[model samples]
Target chain A: MALPVHASPLERIWHYAYLVICALIFVFLVAPILVVIPLSFNAEPYFTFTDKMLSLDPAGYSLRWYDSLLTFGMLAPDAPRDGAWYADMWRNAAWVKAAKNSIIVGFWATLLATVLGTLAALGLSRPDMPWRRAIMAILISPMIVPIIIIATGMFFFYSNPCSILGFECGRLTSTYTGIVLAHTILGIPFVIITVTATLVGFDQSLNRAAASLGASPRRTFFRITLPLILPGVISGALFAFVTSFDEVVAVLFLAGADQQTIPRQMWNGIREQISPAILAVATILVVISIGLLTTVELLRRRSERLRGMTPR
Target chain B: MADLTAAAPLTTADGRPLKEALARAQRRAKTRAFLLVAPLLLFVIVSFVIPIAQMLHRSVYHDGFSANAPAVSAWFAANPPGTPPDEAAFAALAEDFRAMKAAKTAGEAGTRVNYTLPESRSLFTKTARDADRLAPPYRDAFLAVDPKWADPEVWQAMRSSSSAYTSDFYLSATDFRHTADGGIERVEPRQRIYVYLYIKTFVLSGVITLLCLILAFPVAHLLATLPMAKANLLMILVLLPFWTSLLVRTTSWMVLLQGQGVVNETLLSLGLITDSGRLRLINNQTGTIIVMTHVLLPFMILPLYSVMRVIPPSYVRAARSLGASSWTAFRRVYLPLTLPGIGAGALLVFILAVGYYITPALVGGADGQLFSNMIQFHMSKSNWSLAAALSAMLLAGVLLLYWLYDRLIGIDNLKLG
Candidate 1:
């Protein structure tokens, strides 16, 4: 395609203005995160960069914090060799445990929500499904309801021991199962919405073609339908993962001290202590989130391309 | 021809009525679709809908008064045209109070009454002890224990409980109702909360939505119009923060904006001030707005960028070729074309902002707190009814805005994908 030429000086000025504003925003958006990344490497255990660093001194460069984080008394099976450092690390152990809980909760919630949500999307997208719009609206209600309300409801419902199909499960409040279930409830909507969007352009004809070629329904789905929808499934799963990982308010009421997730840990850290180790964790989290999101974006684009819904 | 005709009927088999021999197949397909959706539907109903319904029910739930105090109800039911028949009814109330005070679950009842009328505790206790006495003077003494009871104010409150449901919390949320004294009044001026908070929430959400658009528009434009490779790179950069925990992002803002943090440090180093700037970035309205705008920008950008991506470049080129200045072309043509995106982004950002709790709580001072904070407060205090009432108001507000936006812009037409 031939590129359009610029027309007027006013247009040129407008373009430059647009570019300048965008550049400024990009800096504003990225600056704090970038600042944290380097500060994570600071030899000093404070927010400030040291004088040595200001003067380009090599002594300022130390991986002590990183080493401290990994071997931090929080993770140590025994007390640290250094007593003071061990106490400090032990003080931070709640945060480490919370972060660990966050990973487990995020993974399971994401996996379950994505699988269930994808199935829901497929079922809803089928032309013959009755009350598709109503079903979708119901599925998406969790996304619309305020988190506090959801938290309150979950608190009440799970505080009492409830039985399902004669299987007596005790009160779920303060349990890992409770938090994961709550997180999945929150995560599933995002997966459903995104996957449904992906499914909108999916070709039923391909599945029909496979079926006509004497493929079993299960085999056709696995070989043809699943592959075409893989990108959607991945993106949906990533969205679910991010949603669960970042969730806090619902978990706040549902999770006990033992079940505290990373966000809750960070919440306490911010409220109680102004530790730079949190900055380190924040930087690490930002990196991981960016990586995951980029992959999601790529998957989204690939899904669109695979469905031939948009130009590559 | 015969083979093809037979195959046509075979194809029709796919669409055959379930009433015929295909009943089993139709039932199986229906069962499969239901099975596929049953788990999520079950989860939402059990986890989301039923709990919310129960919360809503709690708002009007006078079980504390009705279920626990059946004697009180019976006394009212037995008392006929008022000869002040009189001492017997008082005796019955006293008996009910004695039972209520002595009951193991009395505390729960007291707590519930405390939410509505905190002073009811002493009344119940006094009535109980007085009613337990076996004398006429005792009955007169009980009546005198709180003269307010004879004034019909207390009687009215008690009588209003004839129905099992009450709208007291909802009325309180709106700040207009009759006091127990039968005085049609507003809540105490100082206790006159919720209305203002609701207004502030709406205004704050509106401000944040506008700010996101202002901040996101240029960036979204650049991302939409840049060279393909560069645009994708910039888009990723824009979305990068979104993948991180919202709590972490909000906290990071707190860290950066604190008095001794990097922003102030950079300013100090630049000789902007002799000391770190005392901007009071955390725990203020400015901080809330700034953090919220940043957090919600991705929501704005994605929709706007998606919408912008679909507008063919040829329209702008053609307008430019027709002697239209770039500003004119954009303002008159391009901007109008991008309205769908703007609408979608605005609706998404506004709705999210209204319901947001953590960002404002972390960054907002007392003056900056939104309605969601009150919702949290009520929930924690075990005032589920009032919490539900407040949430119902919020949900109504959000839905109204959405309805208005849909009416104004046709949200269905603004699909980003």
Candidate 2:
């Protein structure tokens, strides 16, 4: 069918207005992130313009901060002499540890939640499943409940007299395991939600066809169902990874000095000190996030194509 | 259903009835599902439910006063002639105090006193110190030291402490109370807090939701209707923030918004204003709103865009063909179709925003602090019961608002896709 174009004068004006509003909103959404890209190249220590002022000086484009971020670590190489921005950031060892912890925790938690959540989604999506709606709601409660409550409960329950196999559980408070477990709990809902969304478009007959052709259930899932759902699973994993990576409040209660995540580190950095290194880290994260999201979009498209649900 | 059941095997491996076999299989499936979900269920029960129960229990659990002053409670209850034989009460109270002092643990006694008296710290210490020196008329001396101790209310608090229970903290948090003094009183006006913070949280959440909707709607529209390749590109860009750590996103805003940040520098370079005119963006209400909007915008867009994508363009085209102007066409035909998405996105953003702690905690100045900040403070302070109460309040508020939204707009029909 030919595209209809009722471009009356009033319609044209409205279209222009809509475009203008949308462009402005897009800028508003992107401005903060875009601002970082240029500032990372700023020669000045300050978040603002350099001494070159209105003049575009080559000297204004030094990479000292980036250099320091890569080599000097988050801690200062020397003692605090003058209150230089880079030195102040490097002085906080906790910030560095937290960042590292966030990566480690995010990676493992994402892996675990994705695998388990995808499996759970498959099991729950079975036609024979009873109380599916109620079960779905129950599974999603962790996402709905306030983190403070969860954190507080985690603090108490993970501390002295921890339960294990109906016995006294060892103290897990302030431990890496505690933080990861907390993050995994938080991550599961995202995995479940995303995977379930993908599964809704899934053609069960593909699996049934494979099964009837003498393929085992396990083989059918691995060879047929797995490949079809891989994109959704990967996207869900990415989301779970991001969720764990970004988590802060729960980590505050559950993590100790050694277990601090990147967000917790950033929090302490902002609250205790302000420095350029944090900006560098933020820039890096923004880039990584953009990259991961692109992958998610790619995978989502692949999944849609696999299911014949949408055009690629 | 009957045919399907008939097609399946009617007996177990041992040739038991089909019903038995089906029941056994059903039980196995139940077991399997339970096993699959057990870790999460166990985690929630232990980490989410029990601690909250403990906190709720502690809100009413008071053992300090009554347990510590058994003789005092008994004497007060008896109201025996002439201060109830000061020697007997004093000796018994002195012995109990000595044991508490020797243990060097506040134990139940400390909890009891803390429950009744908000400032029980020094009182407990002072009382513990004098326990060893009690000779003869200890009751009189104790009463003399703190005349408020003679009140029936204090004695009743001591008596009630036999069981570990009191709603004092919740009362205090809410700024209302039936005091041990047998008077219904408001918590001291100066000490009263949190309620205002709770209201401020709701207001802040509402504002953020409105801001997100305003900012996300057009972007979502553009994303939904754009050419496929471009739309996919834009959608990825929109979802980019979701992939990053929230801390990183908020911190990026801080770097961009702070006094010396890029925004100020640009304005300075542009000669928009003098040095002092660099926008005061970070650590204020404005900064909090700006950062929160940035962090929450994706949530609003994703849902709205997903819903918008499925809405056929023909409806709006038909409206325009029927002589409706473009704006009228969109408003009359497009907007209603998108309402479900809008409502869903709004609910998601608002619910998430209400519980938001990190962004506000980082960017919000004193004036911008939300109720979650207090909840964090209480949790860190090891005041589990009060923290639980605050969380319970927040959860209730979320549920109530959700119920209201469902009632008003029909949440079941609000689809994100």
Candidate 3:
């Protein structure tokens, strides 16, 4: 806020000092994220910036770290950048496999969470919904409870997946289905919250009007409700996807070698070796999240507009 | 009765009783709503709820001794507490030992008892192998095999272990044990790490929460008081971190905070310290606190900003006009108005921090490990029972805070940006 016109110089000084403090806080928030981008380009293995780098020497910086992420696990590092090379990189490179698995898991988990969570949100957002408060609490608990606890619980439960039914349905632990299932539970809360928030501004009278015009419930949802809430649904799906993609604890517990995700690979890398390849991955993830964040923000603004909620 | 009641019932426009018609319609609506939610409710129950319930059940479901050592278990059941082991008890023990030896199950059985009584695992295995050669007057024979058989503590453990369902895991979780005389007693002080970790978890979480609130208050206040466009631009600073992968942020902290890294390098060049005197910021509690505070700051800022935005600035101005100083006006008017936000943000951060695993696992050295790290240790040891007990305790605290958060600032108000 602008300082009030006052006689004392102290108040104006404090106002300028306050602005400076805010600037520092913003720097604190952004500095770490920016620091990694430069480090990932360092020619040397060290994390520190070289003296040459500070002197504006181009030789101090290179794309080797990013390139290493590709060729580290490749069968032939010196080969031409051909289709076979890319295919081999995908097959052999640990990070590439992790990226692939992350996409696969993120997609499936998002699909499951969005469908189930959206339907449930529709029900919970209804005026006539029963036990609404309690159900909302239960559905959102996966977000509040610690990941370690959830991972441990899933470890025990997935280890003996068939014991409850008194049959040998085999173990879920270390399986793709198990990891996807755990991620789905973890992702549901975001989906429910976003979709339900969207549903809150929805008008029930539209559904009534559609029904009065003889449209079926399913038809009315597609024509009147689904299109209107599409932005919310997409945003929720993005959230669910990110939750699954960023998650490592569940992958650590539920998934095996076959289901390794990017975060899990990073966990191993950071624990065993703090290489610049991880910095490369971190930089890439930051860029991806920037893209996702922009999409969600745009979708949110569109949703508000569709709902006619412009600022008064 | 139906005919008589139907004749006198309040009628509707469609000729059905109004009460019946309304009740039927309401019932149908409830069913429809429930039907829409049932699939997800069931999915969550199977995926999340049931697993947690099963894990908690392990706290009382240790059946190792009772299930394996049937003979010893039976003798413990037959004799009363504080009973001296005589011939029959010794004979049952001898028989059980022989049976365990043949089945090669003595190791598993020993591990179970050793969970409570340390260094007794080898005793069971050693005694089991020698049980076949021991003579009668079974007490002396058993004593000759292993002197621990005569110790009252062994018998006490046996008696307690007779039941398949026992609170031994919970007792061990709290660093307590059931004594031979059936009285509870504290464990050896050296072995009491879980309780220490739990307390440290609480204290650290509180410190983190307080730090977050202190740091977040000013930023949130600025965001609230600024113009919408400026605030929205600044809001990206908060939201970017919120949306970034947690591992990425933690790795960035590692890159910056490690010794010989940017922070230390900057300090060294600035004549802040000698090369040998560079601070050990990484892989320790300091690193943990700093990184976690950064990561969780958004959680604190968002809720506080949301609450602070709605608080009218005129409240402070009105107080100032009444001749109060700026500090006094802020304290009485602005600060009081932001209490709910503080509660929400503080509780949210505290809950998340208390259960933190990954950050501490990465940056936290041996000394910096939190309660979740200990739980991870127990889990890796295949000590699922102990882990479950620890998890149950952690879960209780989180659920309580969660309920409080819901009660004070409803879950519907939880926002990401």
TM match of model 1 to true structure: 0.88
Scored against the true structure, residue A132 in model 1 reaches a CA lDDT of: 63
**lDDT comparing candidate 1 with the true structure:** 0.75
- Ranking of all candidate structures by their lDDT, best first: 3, 1, 2
lDDT of 1 by residue, B251-350 (tens): 6787688787777777788888668345677788888899999988888998899889889988987998898876799899999999988988898889
When sorted by DockQ, best at the front, the candidate numbers are 3, 1, 2
* lDDT (tens digit, per residue) of candidate 1 on A1-312: 222374356756666776778888987776766677777777787676778877878788677665544444354535556876566565666656677898899899988898888888788777666666567767876776778778887887787636323356678899988888888889877878777777777888998999999999889979998898888788878878888888888788888878888788677767787566777777778888878876887787878777776464
Give one digit per residue, the lDDT tens place, for model 3 in B1-417.
889876787789779978889999998999899999999999999989999898889878887778779987888877778888888888888888888888888887777787777677899889878868977888889878777788888888777877878888889999998787889999889988889889998998888888888788889999999998888888888889988999999999999998878999999999998899999998888988989999999999999999999998899889988999888998888898999999889988998998999999999998788988888999998888888899999999899999998999999888777
Clashing pairs for model 1 are none
Question: Candidate 1, residue A178: CA error in Å?
Answer: 1.3
Docking class of 1: acceptable
List CA RMSD, all candidates. Answer: 4.6, 5.2, 2.7
What does TM-score give for chain A of every model? 0.85, 0.86, 0.96
The regions of model 1 sitting more than 4 angstroms off are: A1-10, A42-53, A56-92, A161-169, A308-312, B1-35, B77-86, B122-139, B143-152, B161-163, B180-183, B271-277, B401-417
Off by over 4 Å in 3: A78-81, B1-10, B135-137
i-RMS for every candidate: 2.9, 3.3, 1.2
Docking class of 2: acceptable
True contacts kept of each: 0.50, 0.45, 0.75
